[model samples]
Target: MFALISLSDLENDFINPYDLTQRLNRFVALEYATQVVLVAVLLLGGKWFLAGLQAAMLVYLLHSWHVKQHTVDATDVFRQLPVQKKRRLIMFGSFLLFFVIITYRFIESIIHGLLTEEGRAHAKKLFQDAAASVHGY
Candidate 1:
């Protein structure tokens, strides 16, 4: 819901309502598709919590970049409103903090995973499979 709201704000500048709706729908579809792929990757990697956090952070970062581009192209009136500016800054700051925390957690998880016996076995199998494939080529 929040994602849709942010996407709508980013797309609000379109002059045609039909075009705006189409673009929003496209974005929503694309986001869903990307998330499905991320979920598949997470499942394969077996780091559900950390990988999911990273995926969410990546999505937020992409959405923020999209919104920032639209805001940059906005008129001075849109850009200078103190209320809007404050709201945007607060939201961006909060998200940035979350992003940092998630990233730290992700790195920590990677190191922890590598230190575990099961993780080492998985890594060894992966490497062996890769080597076998290379030899086959």
Candidate 2:
């Protein structure tokens, strides 16, 4: 029984598609990180403002959509499989979803930062500079 179990474990490692899927799954987290940093740059009481935030969000959403669609396309191939296979699919899907959610919350933190009194005070100078540039005065 021990030998049989050991063989099974080896077989799993050798045959599991997760080895490939995990490599691809890494890209999902990478996308989330990229989006978070861009959001921070746009909203973290620095140089950018609402316009930059919007642009960053748009770009991130587009990239996320593309990756999600690709995942869906790949998932369709296994749609007819059994529960066990479906469970594995769900696990990977949730991993990507969780990272994306975490990234969004990070962006929300930046929004909170901007809404605070101190952050608003910082924004005032930025707005004044924008006004001066716009009016060329």
Candidate 3:
């Protein structure tokens, strides 16, 4: 099958010798390489996106603050705001999506780092101890 051949190719390229230590070392090396690539992309590709988001949020906050300062009542500014349900939903959804993406990335990094045999063993022991305490086993 094609999948088997692809797996064989990857094995030959990256894990041919079936040595755990070598594989772990290789994984760490690749992780460093990926970190470099991610830093480069964040610097080059993410800069503009971050800047635009910062500007938009800053402008909105400043406008709200100015309105509050000018008004005598604290809740006056909020009362004057228009209820654009569609825009509010879009912003809320986008924020939730961003949070989910960040959380997923964090979990992925943790799982990937703990994929090595030693790391897995440590994680297993930690979880087992926690489970034992919870179950009073």
Candidate 4:
């Protein structure tokens, strides 16, 4: 959520809403809002603890992006290129592929590292402490 908010703010004047990053951000936000609404309505609707936060988020998402009209251009020139030309977009600097793959591998390694036995034990201990604090233990 911070990432979405930050990118949207940073790219406030982004020329194309149809841009892949923007589209992905929107899709991710939509999925999140959907999950929040579903969880709030189905699970926490009657709870007094966190229901208000959940409901407020639903209201916020609905009031903000839902009511706004964000249109993607159907006649975008970028979309009119031949399939082969489109495939060669980053070919001028083949390093782009290497960068993407390396970045993906680095992130994957970090994710895997966080799931290692020691990492999981530490995370579980932290979560248990959080739960205890929340419950006033």
Which one is best on TM-score?
Answer: 1
Error of 4 at 51 (Å): 1.1
In candidate 2, stretches whose alpha carbon ends up further than 4 angstroms from where it belongs are 1-88, 131-137
lDDT of the candidates, in the order given: 0.58, 0.52, 0.48, 0.49
lDDT of 4 by residue, 109-133 (tens): 8789778999888878989999999
- The local lDDT score (0 to 100) that residue 137 gets in candidate 2 is 53
Residue 108, candidate 4: Cα error in Å is: 32
The window of 10 residues in a row where model 2 has the poorest summed lDDT is 72-81
For candidate 4, what is the total of clashing residue pairs?
Answer: 0
Candidate 1 Cα outliers beyond 4 Å, as residue runs: 1-80
Candidate 2, residues 59-93: lDDT per residue as tens digits?
64565467553232223323322432443454445
CA error at residue 97 for candidate 1, angstroms: 1.4
Residue 52 in candidate 3 has what lDDT?
Answer: 55
Q: Sort all candidates by lDDT, best to worst.
A: 1, 2, 4, 3
